[model samples]
Target: MSVRTIAVKYGVHRGTIPTFVLRSGGKLRSTGLNNERRASAAILYRDGHTLQEVADRLGIDPKTVRNAVVAEGISPRPRGRRPMAI
Candidate 1:
């Protein structure tokens, strides 16, 4: 669960959750896209979807999608428009 979720559930402030977790020897998880989201982003990018397109579809930031794509070992297409065929 996200820090925000834990905070809301326990009626604690979001900022304090991380501190408490660490003090208790609990490791904090990384935020942003998870493994499933990463896989979906990779599939969409591989299918020719642009970073923005994938982000829109997944409700995430384009930069996040780009990072996920790169981490998946897929080469992202060059930015801007694609060339038109005659």
Candidate 2:
């Protein structure tokens, strides 16, 4: 699939798709340490911490926490408050 298609299907930025495709070519592999970190982030999120909280605790960016959560097949809560009814 094209990068745009993959991005839309996966709900990621189009810019990220190329990097993912390139990484899939075996030029780089995910390490156990990375998996552990992602797991840790997921756990923190599951335990009721917000993404920003998890990121702060992990010393990573909120976007990193969000991506890690999504990579683990978990849907993260929306970031902001609900809109008021008209």
Candidate 3:
């Protein structure tokens, strides 16, 4: 479980949970996109899906999706809306 979850369950501050974990030699997990999610984000972006679209489909933040696609060596599309072609 995440520290936040534990804190909420036991009524402790989220910050205090991390301190207790460190004192007990427990390691905290690093958050963010994993390899599979990154690959999925990249493929979706390459297939012309907007970052926000991919994020919504994957239930993650758009910035996280953006980072995932970039890490997969895909260049991000230009910002702002694209003009619909005639």
lDDT of each: 0.87, 0.79, 0.87
lDDT tens string, model 3, 1-86? 97889999999999999899889999988777889888998898888788899899999999999899889998788986533555
lDDT of 1: 0.87
Candidate 2, residue 57: the lDDT equals: 95
Compare the candidates by TM-score and give the number of the best one.
Answer: 3
Positional deviation of residue 52's Cα in model 1 after best superposition, in angstroms: 0.4
Writing each residue's lDDT as its tens digit, candidate 1 over 1-86 gives: 88889899999999999999899999987766889889999998887778898899999899999899889998777897533445
Candidate 2: Cα lDDT at 37: 95
Model 2 misplaced stretches (Cα beyond 4 Å): 1-33, 81-86
Error of 2 at 84 (Å): 20
Collision count for each candidate, in order:
0, 0, 0
Ten-residue segment with the worst summed lDDT in candidate 1? 77-86
Q: Can you give the lDDT of residue 53 in candidate 3?
A: 91
Clashing pairs in 3: none
Stretches off by above 4 angstroms in model 1 are 1-29, 81-86
